[model samples]
Target: MPPSTISRVINATNGRDGELVTSQQCIDHIRTQRVNNIGHECISIIRHFQSMTANDKFGLPFAPFTGVNHHRQSTLLGCALLADEQEDTFVWLFKEWLKCMHGIEPDAIITDQDRAMCNAIHSVFPTTRHRYCYWHMQKHIIDHLPTLVSRYGEQFQRYWGLWCNSSSIEQCEGYWVEMKEKFDINEEGDGWLQTVYKCREHWVPCYLKDSFFAGMRSSQRSESINAFFDGYVNSQTQLHEFVTQYKKVVTHRRLSEAHEDFKSLNTKSVMLLGHPIEIQAGEMYTRNMFDVFHTEFKGFGTEFCEELRKDIVEYKVCKFTDRGKWEVVTYE
Candidate 1:
């Protein structure tokens, strides 16, 4: 994996540059490099490049690359920042793979509104699709608009509800204005909402026909794949080991997807919770178990089906049944 190699390079360079190896030593170095005993999370920056086929078969307007070299004309580039202590390292590593192996420029990138990653992207691929993840936006809403989230929980939901759910400009705008007016708090709410709307318009241009750009929305798919490494690879693990484990997971996933099918022979609905249905054969969990839903499908299930259905009215799946279990599904 490019990330595995990248991490090794980083560690080797640091080791050669006389950087500390232990956490305590690093902490001491940071203290010596600063004032007071403030603390901060360690972070790493990695850069990568990718390329996409510029063929016009997909109805794309035109290819961005221009060169006589056949290979150079279809390349795209990317970069990522991994937290030293968090499983988010997979994100950076994945970006590296896109650049080094896929030969496709990452059309879009999504992450929390992290200043470090933002800076890294600016330095690496300034023109790449790098936007703040909607999940993170909702997180901001939760942290910043706690009162609204607690009061008109549904209304608060409407804000993000429009974000990920709305397909057309009118629908998105209408819901945005309604939510803003309902939850007016000094001008902070309005300002935040307006900023979100503008950012959404800039990054999620598929909603507007004039600036329609596909593949710019936040990528929860990558997030889902990376989530598995959360506790498995943390700040304490050596960078080399972390990359090795992540590559094994990535390889297995790719191999599995290669042997997948997307055809549907039939459709069936089953009765859930006293409702009517056709498919059945399983034991219900007798106890409440903490099940972490995949990142993309979080907040979507039978319990919240009604809410989810209302919000995702304009949903669409590119293809069905990509593999035995996992599938590639995208919605707007």
Candidate 2:
């Protein structure tokens, strides 16, 4: 906004007032999805504010609040134009968002490891589970541990995968020790590794696997949403231009979703497996969600489940491989 436009925000006649506005239509869309999937254990909130008004977060004004629906689609819950990215600014923004949603707090929220944002979330939403974007941390490791990444490469990545996918906290800890020993990582010199380990509960998978994140593990979905805006807005986009283009972006997403919903409802999905469960899932789930369920069902062909002798409801699910990957799930 120009000096003249910013000056008359309070008393302007031509619809210029506050920096923030939450759309009721977006809230209704999210509320409808919530009512439909009330059984889900986790409903996550994600805030993305990159490459919007300016390159840096402080200069950027747009914060797109998104949530995952039953279809695993990123639904826009609300949006805000912050004056700045200060801790106070973020706190106020989150509080306003909470009010707009009728004080219904989300089960979890995902964001990059920005100190101010983290602090703000902690202050405002104290009980909400907070998780950091692993991809952001991955880039941090690449930048900080370039020598280790370059020397080990794929071997490092394989070990990294094993460590990240640890089945239990103890297993994760054991893998961390093993990784340090195998790679000869210096205990005294690797400050970044130590720092990240202290905050492992926020980003590591095993610590968060039990919590529902709608199967989201990173802010990549936010990146995808930002990608959609590439054609409409760029660095040269002024505040007014951005506001105009944003409506188009939202409209495009709605049209795309409507198209998908139409296909999901009208077409018959061919079942790969002849299981009764597959048929039931196809009927119950959205097209994308059914596809996910079908893929997992296909994985059952590669794995074998063994029931515990003492308990009928307890079983071990595993693939008979040299890698020895397996998991246990209990039914009530």
* Candidate with best lDDT: 2
Model 2 per-residue lDDT tens digits across residues 189-249: 4677778888889998889876888888788877777776789887667777777988988
Error of 2 at 59 (Å): 3.8
Superposed on all Cα atoms, the candidates' RMSDs to the truth, in angstroms, are 19.3, 18.9
Total clashing pairs for each candidate: 16, 0
TM-score (all chains, Cα) for each model: 0.36, 0.67
Who wins the TM-score comparison? 2
Per-residue CA lDDT of model 1 for 1-332, tens digit only, reads 34445456557777576553554555565667666433432221111111112211222111111111111111122223333423334445545655675655545545566555566655555555566666666666667566546765756765765654777777777766676566663444456655656667444434534531233334454444445445455434444565576566556544443332111112222223432211221122111111111222222321221122555575433333336443435455
List where candidate 1 sits over 4 angstroms from the true fold: 1-104, 142-167, 170-191, 194-198, 202-219, 230-247, 261-332
Model 2 / residue 32 / CA error / Å: 66
Tally clashing residue pairs in candidate 2: 0
